[model samples]
Target: MSFQKLILRLAWSVLIGGSLLAGSTQAQQLPAARDTSFTVRSAYLKEKKNRPSISIAQPALPPTVQASYNLTYCTLGARNLQLDIFYPKAKRKKGYPAVLFIHGGGWRSGDRSNHLPMAQQLAAKGYVTVTAEYRLSTEALYPAAVYDLKAAIRWLRANAKHYPIDTTKIAVWGFSAGGHLAALVGTTNGDKQLEGSDCNTSHSSSLQAIVDVDGTLAFLHPESSDYQVSERPTASKYWFGASQTEKPELWQQAAGLNHVTSQTPPIVFINSSIDRMHAGREDMIQKLDAYHIYHETHTFPDTPHTFPLFNPWFEPTLNYTADFLDKVFKAKRWAAKLGLSLLGDSEDYTCKS
Candidate 1:
């Protein structure tokens, strides 16, 4: 067995005991490096061993933007969390804004790679984009993923020189399950668990803007009663660490809606009417209004949750996100408003080819 695999096995045995924690809760074993006639050696090492490292030089002359893949950073457990970075490649350039993306799979089964196409699309538009990977459900739960996300933000700020990231202007975009995570990260300002270790040297997980794509926002709402899963209680249980009825307080604590405040980041929360899972988006937006936080809510006709990425609403949604970012980052007086008026008349956001 490889030494790292041995150590990992021992460590996990101690943490997980005999049985798996729950659904999709299996840890991926590191491959053993050496094997005998009856033993199996590493199956994946050939690719890593053969690939040559191409070091991308920081462009001496300023370019409007640049993109790179597979930038890695450490998470709370020292797991090598990887992210893809997109930014302006030129020196003397205005530190372009940064956007971190989290994917959706009920907090259990998504990857940073799923956001690759989206990251590349954004990177092409002069914004620094990072598609990040956080530990999944089978291995960890609840706050573990949040911790990794916060660590990613901190790592980006600390290593601003490594990429052309704007520390002062940061945004988070998440889809479905990821939308809930993005909202939670943006809403939770001083959460100690989400804070990075002493090595981190940047501001907190407070984002300048939040883009929620078909995610649940409230823990106590009747909306989530629709997701009936047998193996797991509900999607909320997988995400917030408790069944809503079993532990209301814990659910509320993790619910992004519960964390809203005047200081909450400007948010663009979107969902499709055909997706029953997001029945709560309107209610959540109402709550955002109560808190006097600036936000925009959109619903696409006949489209299901998260389908905006490829369906008819895809281009419109992307354009809305880009426009929303510009308004939130540049507008000062309107930042204090919580009404739909902050969107500057609904006609401005009307879908157009």
Candidate 2:
């Protein structure tokens, strides 16, 4: 093994005992260079020991949904980031609301394809759904992924006419690390510093709603598990390129909880039983409550961290997400028609549940 692989193996050993290598033979088969690339298959293998009968969700599109693959949204230096868009074939008179899905891999590993199944399901439910690729920690650290996601949002808006999307009703949905980015994007609308200087600058990167799946809102919160294994390099450390103590400002800047304001959009959080996975959630919700911003929280008891990719929790996950998006986006549409703002004490125009 390479020195890097050896170190990673040692870190895994320290984190989960020697069982890390013994748990899944498939994990050992992956290329050492790409071992950190988290995928649905790898997640299944990791969770199988806990839920022996757990099944993986397969990618299948409904007949009503048409998908376009590998559409390049932005080109950074020599790298071209691409996205997959799924939309209903039957066009809506007012255009469909758009949702951009970001996959979780602890900021280093997940791919856009991780959420393709969810994208197709939501597309079938009358929304333009997109799965986007962003810079991983291995490629670029910290705000690069954030910048790429915001750029993707801008691309969706710039191309709204072609895809039957309502430019005014775009939301971001993310899993784990991606969920962190999604929530951050929702809270930091019009943030010049987080917004990159490439691709679709003419369009705004603001989001109407946010769906965070098992993502932490604050990295330094007491409830966070980020630095629990002090000896090993945590994913946040890798992505931030520094320890929390070494660079507290960067950590706070990336935290969704630190950015929440009254202008922040409606948000829904779907969580697993793991408390550390959704750390800083309750505190952020407290802020939302103080502002009276619409938000919902749902927890799946006794489920694996990656519950949305598995069978039993997959359908419910989809239901909660779709229901939340429908309520929030529909309310926005209603408010637009009545020329009333949904922000502030407009509780009557805001969505519940």
Candidate 3:
């Protein structure tokens, strides 16, 4: 039972058995309900000796804080959806701005530990970072994963005092399928009632901004007139339900771009040129422009999807993310050197309000 195999199994199960929409209603879009018990577990994953171990030589002191453990916040079936939070432990009066990260495995397979290195690095650079696991595409469909992550945000807000997080300064960052969820969370802020059952506080789970890396924003491609369907039959069948022609409106509802509003938060979309999701990225940027939303787009000249995470530009990309978040938190127009360490790269970035 290696880690990869375990995650694959979980993914398979979720996509196969759990992704039944609320009901096969005749409506254009299936009405979604709050899924409170969205629990994820590491027991679904085993230690992989061959793969890279999630070990980072974090400095052992303040201003470089680190915390690693599973927090049982949401539950699904017998397993509790666990989240890993990492932050720079500072002696300052208030905690740092929190960044919630979601990993990408095509809404199917991925683990919280997969993003541990990024979490640790961000934490070391003085940001409260969290990587969480939500029910995958197998167990639930489009809105389920979306709802679970929103629940995680609500859980963080509810336990802000316990974690000493600054609720007002929260941003979401995700890749691939996780990127889709992140973008949805950013744009769909008006729909807050889906906070699920774990809410007992007034803190809102709405994100201040979003960072989407190679996620599908536009399900309906502009370049393709044929509407060549997705290869993942289960993904298409479960998300859109039946034929695209039979339910064009439902299919549109599943598309993230259709939901974008002027109220959408500031966004930073990054992607690789060769990725299949590139067209969707461009479409999202165009839509953002049409809505007058503040956004930044970065394309990794000649790389593939998720390459920015564990390879050559790892430090650079993470640094850019930290810097990007810094800008978003300063959206209120600050008047100080809200500078970033830039992963120790000798880059000087000092801005004022």
Per-candidate local distance difference test: 0.63, 0.83, 0.63
* Candidate 2 segments whose C-alpha is farther than 4 A from its true place: 1-36, 227-229, 332-353
Return the candidate ranking by TM-score, descending.
2, 3, 1
lDDT of 3 by residue, 18-105 (tens): 4553322222133233332221223112212222432222223344675868887676545467788877666446667788889876
Q: Give, for candidate 1, the lowest lDDT window spanning 10 residues.
A: 31-40
Cα-based TM-score, every candidate: 0.72, 0.86, 0.73
Q: Write the per-residue lDDT of candidate 1 for residues 86-116, one digit (tens) a residue.
A: 6655553557778998887777665665555
Name the runs in model 3 displaced over 4 angstroms: 1-18, 21-63, 192-202, 223-226, 230-234, 238-243, 331-353
Local error of candidate 2 at residue 44 (angstroms):
0.8
Q: Cα-based RMSD of the predictions, in order? A: 11.1, 7.2, 9.5
Best by TM-score: 2
Give one clash count per candidate, in the order shown.
3, 0, 12
- Sliding window of 10 residues with minimal summed lDDT for model 2: 22-31
Top lDDT: which candidate number? 2
Higher-TM-score candidate of 1 and 2: 2
lDDT (10s digit) by residue, model 2, range 204-287 = 999989999999899888999864536457778777766677788999899999998878888999999999988899899899
